[model samples]
Target: MTKFFLLLSAAAIAAPAHSQTSPDSDAPEVVVTATRAAQPLSEIGQAVTVIDRAEIERRQTTVLSDLLATTPGVTVTRNGTVGALTSVRIRGAEADQTLVVIDGVRVNDPSSTGGGFNFGNLLSSSVERIEVLRGPNSVPWGSQAIGGVVNIITAAPTEGVQARANAEYGYADSVFASAGVSGKSGPVSGSLTGGYLRTDGISSATSGTERDGYRQYGATGRVGVEFAPGIGLDLRGYFADSRVAIDGFPAPDYVFADTPEYSKTREAYGYAGLHANLADGRFNNRVAFTIADINRDNYDPSFGNDPSFIGRGRSERYEYQGDFRPLDQVRVVAGVEREDSRFNDGFTFADTGITSVYGQLIVKPLDVLTITGGVRNDDHDDFGSHTTFGANAALALRTGTTVRASYGEGFKAPTLYQLFSDYGNRDLDPETARNFDIGVEQAFLGNRARVGVTYFNRRTRNQIDFRDCSPSELTTPGSICANRPFGVYDNVARAEADGVEFTLALRPVDALTLTANYSYIDTENRSVGDDFGNDLARRPKQTASVNADYRFAFGLSVGGTVTVVGDSFDDVGNTTRLDGYALAGVRAELPICERFAVYGRVDNLTDTRYETIAGYGNYGRAAYGGVRLRLK
Candidate 1:
């Protein structure tokens, strides 16, 4: 890690030294996730990052998590290889506190112990855009927005029939393919996509020999119809069936290998929406219904023959949203949401319901200043009601500098598994966070270069964790064992995280773009005694990334990415530490024709041996190449 940082410093000293500028006339279009409404990137007061379609295709990523791991202020922790339990944390927050949204629906699994969205099976084939809004944004987004929001937006229908296909083959006998089509006729538009992926991955445990394999088949479809100039109806559906090998306790040789334990998971989601604008486009409304279902069956071929059904979970959501511009300089957005979650194990079934109402106002009293404020109230069937608030401000000075600041309160309800599982505790309270951030950005050299620095702080309370309360301490009324009995979840953990983020973007030439970002995070576990004042798990003190790309003539391009991560602990008490490392990759694309192209990438150029988890396997030097075809 030290050598890596030294190299990074040398590169910075030798380069033009800046980053990709915030969206401007020379940049991309407006983004909708930052404000819950379409707005330019520079007009928002929050730290939001957007990875668009072009960038996605340029990278030719296999999974959604890979792309997120390269961004600033985010961390991806995996148990072992692909298809394993992968968790994404933003700025030292727990996995469950970060919300994942596909289109307009929150997709956290209620059956999971933490009620967090798993990043294992999310493919990048059908996604057109991904916007990561950092910090607590609980006003527009509801519960579980304590850390931030990852909005995966899919491809919208385009005019005329357009088709695209992709195929890739790489090391470890990995294979990937995807085909998709989209079209629009008059007022009707639709899109359909399908993909398949398989990989023979390495062992879960470092000492294991046998390989673990994974495969996934998925499809997505969407249709839209416009009844008027600014009115539309839309329907969408997505499904993925994945088979993955997993690990449990170690064997006699202390290796978690030679096990025939695997799981097959089928996840499905459906959504329907009615969106329209009325009264000369001043009032806009959207009514949507979403359904998310997950079914899993665990199997141990060593004991039986075929995979057996293990568990099933489902979530249904309904929402009504409205945006109105009462005055030229004032806008208001409000929404009402209700969600139902259920889980069944073929015996004991549990369910819960949550309802919420939220509203926000945006006022632009001065052309150079913007103000935003919002409030939200949520009622959980199991717990009582809770309220949240958020506010933001942005001011643009005439000297080509912008100042921004924001503060928000966030909360997350307990999951069904946490309330009804074997270690369930019915007295748990909702987790909460108080978040604040401030920053200033300045553009130079005809807006071709930009540099910014931001400081953020978040405090979390009422965190839940399981504990054995038997030895000379508190005990439950029920009895199962004489000496060791009580084990239940409790809200006894609190956390504090503060960080500074620096960004630089510069387009020194017409065909070359350079960007760099660095984050310094200091965290303390202010929990109820145990592990108190300790640094959080899997959160490194510093993370930095640099991206450089130059497009040449004749439809040829080359790009490279480098990331450096600092050392950090891997457990609650900081007993286990995972050494940090550096990763480097280069990519190139060659256009075969007007509608055909071949692209390849080499990852882990240094093959630096490192692990994110103590006993997990790490990916080494690997290479992959593929072709793309477009028909219109």
Candidate 2:
């Protein structure tokens, strides 16, 4: 690693001095909300990755899991096809350690015991791009950002009236269709998008017949108006509904005659915001409000005596943010947000609420050096208050290389279900972590090729986990051990994780582009007990991926990618292990004319049946072909 850094430093110094400058006379820049300010990406002293729309379409990726799998230091597990639950891990951290944001609004539910966002029901067709920031982001974002933050930015209206429709059919008798329209008129602009997807699912061993699988429908609408020269108003709304059949675990002795179960879920989210310029346009400000509602119903006839588990949750949030450029090179940002959440479950559980306030500053002392700092305070109705802070600095040497380092602290408050659920324990405390990272980035081949490498380390204390307890110690005083309920939430563990990641992107030629990413992690969990420390579950020791895209003459383009994941543990006991696997995919696009095009994709071309989630099976080879129509 030291050698790599030295080489990068040397290259950074030489490239700028020898290269010819562009007419723009400015460095390429990307705007991000990493600091709660629209600052350039190059100035942020952290690991950040951006996925644009063109790449999304090129890969024919239809879900968050698909996109995350390609990002550096990130891993995703998919249970099956549409509507199946999906989870993500960053930098060897657990799912709950990552924070998810949609258009600047937090999507994680405070009532969920899992403490993570569920992407099973999210509609990806409306997403324009995604920004992924790795490392502790809790100081700028809130709790649950110990590992990182992922922000999904939706698309806005275009300049002229435009419309498009797409449809695809694939293996397992799956089908999908979507249509969208967007345009600008005078000072008003609007966009509307909708889609439907369905599949019959592959055969399951537990069920003699193929499972019912899933079907989903969703719609999104947005409208924005420029009320004044430097002012705007925007309103956005979205709804999604899905029906999924659940194939429960195999019966004792691994019988395969059980009928498939089923469930239904509905979700709706909406937001409205106003933006304005202040201090003669030197400061930009935004005030926004959002609401989200979710309902889920499950039906399992096999559990004859058990009552159905039904849940309904609702959340509302309000935010006010301001960005001020006090000087040419100094920017200050501050924000305050409040969230109120309520849940009604068939079982007994009380309503819960959480609120937070945050502030940040970014300063550039020299053209090549930038510094950032931020802090946040959060108050939970049940856990009182906790604070987190972060600091980072970046230096760009005269050579074409940049170096950055950062340190931060994060905390995750106990959830309502963890404290007050039917099987919950109230003695559990919040989890906390302190993390640090350092990295370097270098450009070569006339800026057409870029290489980046980073090293990250994190130490977490008072981690929450389940512990076996005797029946007599329970509040209800039942035979808990006899019932085989071996776990209860408690703070009993400390964990440490360190990892190195490398990424390379090269446009070898104008018509071809290639990219590669690799990561290696070392993780350990220390629990005061007879058991020795072990590697954390579901965190692969090594992972790598490579992709290439080529454009042929006559408006034809093709792309391919291959991914490899190393071995990992399945559970805390470390008794179960998931084997490594590799998979490949290819896609092609042909434009028949300016107004129409056709595309096709083949995934898991090798028909690899690998378990991303231990004990759970993944889908086999699948293929999809589609056509798109454009109108202007």
Candidate 3:
């Protein structure tokens, strides 16, 4: 699969030549939020990708997971169909290492034992653009940013009153509806959005008929005021409610028992900030206070005796951040954050809390040189305090070419469940890592053709693992009796992972675009006194993807994408290996009028059967179509 994608990418680059074109001829300018300042894609120094509203409509993507799955260096995993526990990983890092921000506010749950983002609750329609940074971003973002960052920027109000509506239906009896309104009057501007989505998911087994699935409804609103040329304040909030069904264990005939599992989630986030201009236009300052609350309730009927388990988790976070540019060549940003979290299984688990402080600095000595450094200190009540640091330097060699090198340290504090779980047996320490990366980027033909490659290495120490052991009378003052002793978490392993990635984008013609990416990883764990010391899990050896789009003269556009995933192991034993697979998708867009459009998309064009996660079923072939309206 990897070789196939490489060939495809090579073919795209070697195809028929065309005259060079100006940057303006490629596409319209897109604003990004990852840098905290709106800038065109060509000016941003980071490895960023922006998915604009037009692309979103053309692809007919209705969910955050759906959109991210198509991007390079990203993969999505879920425990079950709709509304299930879902997470995204970048490169080959753990899901928890990636940071997710919605409207400039971090939304990762502090109560989760694994520190992963909850993608199941994030809606897609309210988003105007998404900015993705594909490498360590600790210098700009704080903790849990070892892997990368994903920022979801919502739509802003228009100049005058405007309204729009959208609806869609697709395979598996799926239905969706959304509406939004935006307006500005005097010094005030605001936008309000609401939507609902439901789907009877695909069967958990090949021949199974039961359709245990999910339904969700959500609303969001944002308002802002401008007092002066460079001063403003904005506030935003969001709420959602959802219910999903769980898939039971597979039966002898690959059938799954049908059962309804209930899960309700609610999130409210808001921020008030001031943006000011000083020293003419070269100096700027921004300060903001943000608050977020997340609550979740889960009821499952397939665990333990009487087959029932009820749980609730709540988390709240407060943040104060400020960034300043004292001069045109220097930018500094720093922030302090605190998180309070509580969890209950109706009984048995204690509440936990974590707090952290961090700061960063970015300096440019010359027009072609940039340096950045930052550090974070986390003071956890249970595991004490730990500090992490990161630094990077980049140099522009010549026109359309740059090289960068970076080093960073990361740490993950022990969760309450790991330290004080009901069945836990011992204490645990934090996990830590030191990472290094070097890369080069180039854009030729007046920025119409781009290529980038990066190499990364990470060494982890004190890695956590669960251990189970039985005690004898000599050690435990008990008779030599058999017992299924539960496991406990411990920091007892060391490991290293290294990888390389390559990306290319070319627009040889005014109406055609081609993009491709590839990644290869090698990982190993070195731990003595363990049965599977050298095992590698959750890491694929190689992966690749390619995309192409062409626009016709009659206001019609067609695009196709292909992704190939390589073999990976699920556990240390290496006995459970998932086979490699390739999947393809195609999309079409037709403009009905200047302000209206219709789009259709077909995923898994070959009806391929593959699993991104072991023991979890994935969707096969599916088709969807929708209509989009613009009030601009």
Candidate 4:
């Protein structure tokens, strides 16, 4: 109450700032990943973050994972440089527990041995915006959402004819270039983008000195047509081909040399959808179909044979959703979906299918109070049925302050490899999670400056772990043991994680902007094992970042970022240790003309050595200069 009164007094003093509010402002922009329908970020109860294309371009980051690492509640671990295997974890969840979506399609590889999305090959050249929703949100997204969701939106035509191109050169003999064209004509709008990059990257093994190279080419296209006043048809497609050098496992001594090994990856993703607005725009309906396919070929000529392994996977999904606003202050959303997944390796094939239905409601009964609730039912081909639910509330105080809380359930079904492979266990149950969060925020300077704090807790049950089993244990008819010496996946342990996240954004002057965030996570493994009572592997206890940018009157912009990552355990047994590290970077841009700009970036300013993964090597100081052209 005291804070509320203080804010009221501030509002009165700043009454002249009332003209700063707008629906198109950053704070009021519509976000869809939270509830499957567009809602202003200021009205959302869940913790969400949006990174626009302007910020992405200003950072001059080559890989998408680099942009995500600085986000609060997110941690990225890469085995090597770009094109190497990379994992992203949110809120202390495992890598596989988070889901990645591209234009409403789940893109996680079904055939991956780890059953997770590889962030190494993802590029930002064709992205318009990215939304990261933290915490359990499995109601709209079926599986692999125990942690959170990363939703990527591809670029689209905004108005008249437009074209843009970029080219850059950097360290390790790397080169990057991209071109795009977009336009709107009458009832039709479309965009096409293409990019190619190659890098002679640093070594992967900590003790190795040889370089590992990578190359990739990709294209993205989208077209949308309006059939009637409020009806539309959309089509989207993406394809990529790349080859990356591989570093084999080390010997018992945990030291090795780089070898002549590489793997080729090919991917194709497509989406088609139709949307309509009826009943004077009070009712909205949309139907979409999506497909994701991937193929991989591996070769190690140094091993005598020309090849080692080949893999294939595919997934398809069909969905329908509806949003209704029967009352002025109430809204409802409902949806149904079906998805199929398949994995193949020459002689063996595995498949799974799932069907689900979900519903959510939002109501504002009181002038200052808003409530949201949702539930979902999933029916799996092998696991029968499971139910999940979520609830949230938010209150807006008179001083432009807000308080919010939420609780949600999450579940993830076992992968095909876990259920039907040589070391599979068909009796393994789906992993379940219970998560909750509470937060408060206060606005200063008429929303120009803002501060917020959030606390979150999540507990998971029936976690799958692999352990050695004796012959007798494997011989039993009804057991959780496999015959292979590598052990089998089985429900073994439980886990709980709690964390606090803080964020601040301030525009103290018209030409300068500053932002900072910090996150602290504490994890507990409550199962009897070597890792019991220890924190999860690679989950740091503290991570913080600070960034500032300033623009001069002469069309020059300068910015820098400082990042700190605390110490963490690399192995589950808490044996291998990784020391904490801090890194700094700087960037600058100068506008040459209204439609063209020149920029330069320098990373690892102080050349601080660090390792996100225990045995992997990170690049030292690197410099890059690029040119950008835009015409509309």
| TM-score, per-candidate, Cα-based | 0.95, 0.91, 0.87, 0.94
Q: Is 1 or 3 the stronger prediction by lDDT?
A: 1
Models sorted by TM-score, best on top? 1, 4, 2, 3
Q: Across residues 1-632, which tens digit of lDDT does each residue of candidate 2 receive?
A: 33323332332332211101111114665757478666676688888887766677777777667768877899887655557777888888778878887766677755466567777776567777788888878877777887788887777799999888888888888888888999999999999989898888754332345655789999888899999987999898878899887665556765433345677888778889999997897899999999887777777777763436776777788888888889988888888888777766777657667788888888899999999999889987877888899999888776768898999887877766767776566666678889899999887776677778999999988887666766665444443333435567778778888999998877756677767788998888777775448888888888877666677778888777767788888877788898887776777889999988999988876777778765455677889999988899
Error at 195, model 3, angstroms: 2.2
Candidate 4 wrong stretches, greater than 4 Å: 1-27, 250-255, 304-306, 482-484
Error of 1 at 577 (Å): 0.9
Please, what are the lDDT tens digits per residue for candidate 1 over residues 338-373?
Answer: 989998766558999989999989889998888889
When summed lDDT is taken over every stretch of 10 residues in candidate 2, the lowest stretch is: 16-25
lDDT of 2 at 337: 85
lDDT comparison, 2 vs 4, better candidate = 4
2 against 3, candidate with superior lDDT = 2
Q: What are the runs in model 3 whose C-alpha is more than 4 Å off?
A: 2-47, 205-207, 227-229, 250-262, 272-289, 300-307, 423-427, 472-484, 529-535
- Candidate 4: the clashing residue pairs are none
Residue 86's lDDT in candidate 2: 73
Ranking by lDDT: 4, 1, 2, 3
The TM-score, computed over Cα atoms with residue i paired to residue i, of candidate 3 is: 0.87
lDDT of each: 0.83, 0.76, 0.69, 0.83
lDDT (C-alpha) at residue 619 in model 2: 70
The best candidate in terms of TM-score? 1
Report the error of model 3 at residue 171, Å: 0.6
Better of 1 and 3 by TM-score: 1
